[model samples]
Target: MSFDSFLSQIKSKASELKTDVLKFKNKDFLNAAMAGSALIAMADGSVSAEEKQKMLKFIEGNEALSVFSTSDVIKAFSDFIGQLEFDKDIGEAKAYQALGKMKNNVEAARLLIRMIIAIAAADGSFDVTEKKVAQKIAQELGLNPADFEL
Candidate 1:
């Protein structure tokens, strides 16, 4: 009940609130990024270990997405993968729905496209199927595929 103790409690609560606010603000971006990663990872008809590693690295390194913990990113990516595994068509629809959320934010959309491209090429080869998927993602974001040289 001391004044110092009360001040400490308020500070702790404020810090927690800030963290929550940050997570909320970035949730959409995280989902979209993971969605795109899943799409591209599956473009080759399989999700390779290399692709997943690249995605984790990219998200961890990126300033905007670095706020998220590894577990959060992994969960988001796994959710997309699970959807894709259960049903291809439905999974794609949902992934596109997530990407569509960023359609209006050109900067975020561009970053997402870049992230997916990096993931696709992570296995040392960017195949035709992967490029096609990336193109679709770019279009979903209301961006020009050629802009990213897709």
Candidate 2:
């Protein structure tokens, strides 16, 4: 191959590596975001298509989470949903555990709360059940639900 071609290849590979590294560093945050999304989506005992779309949109738009592919986000969300389906108490516990990881990062926690609220309202009706779940998620992240108008 030409030297320029080789250089281009290397730069492409480096960019891919950088993206991978960013995804790894933000994995915890991704999981936490998905967990919160799942909890709110399932709050009313039914996960709506709009709710799922809202989550994907948020992840695609968010700088920190944009590095992750849609499949990765879906898998994380599915894992939380599967756990909840198998056992509500256990699933909720696991979700809360994931959220608790961000308890100390006040900025991230606040952002998470906002994202959760958006997901809950994605159906165009943020009901009491979803509000309660959002509140619980804020609490898990050591945030104030009222701050997000939950």
Candidate 3:
């Protein structure tokens, strides 16, 4: 397909996906995932290209979230990072709330929590700020601290 056609196709798919995500009642899970991913990307005060790639890869590969289109995944990450750029506390609060929404599905919740921990540890070492954020995320998931020990 021509580049224009490709772009058009993507836009159409994105619109459809947007509707799907909007219909999702689990805004908290989406928000939490977005917030955690953003925090992981921005833990060092800036988001790196490599970190962004890792987050995209993880979200794309996640089975539980297979319903999310690549564009939606990208959109959520972008939303999270953009929020962080404006205010850290607000971003963290959003992520914390998102995590809180995924408490019922134990496995899904744990998977997200584990992914958040992994993302935080991706850039070599998990800093105090990252750990604290991860802990908060874990609490939102209603998981034990021992599960993702500092």
**Number of the top-ranking candidate, with TM-score as the measure:** 1
Candidate 3 at residue 139, lDDT? 73
List the pairs of residues colliding in candidate 1.
none
lDDT (C-alpha) at residue 27 in model 3: 49
Error of 1 at 101 (Å): 0.2
For candidate 1, the lDDT comes to: 0.80
Q: So what's the TM-score on candidate 3?
A: 0.64
In candidate 3, residue 128 scores what lDDT? 88
Cα lDDT of all candidates, in order?
A: 0.80, 0.77, 0.70
Point out the worst 10-residue segment of candidate 2 by lDDT.
16-25
TM-scores of all predicted structures: 0.74, 0.73, 0.64
* Deviating ranges (above 4 Å) for candidate 1: 1-25, 48-65
Off by over 4 Å in 2: 1-25, 48-65
What's the residue-level lDDT of 30 in candidate 3? 68
Write the number of the candidate with greater lDDT, choosing between 1 and 3: 1
Residue-wise lDDT of candidate 2 within 10-122, one digit each (tens)? 66754654454364458888889889988887887765677566666765555445567878887998899879878989999999999999899887787777657755665
Q: Determine the backbone clash count of candidate 1.
A: 0
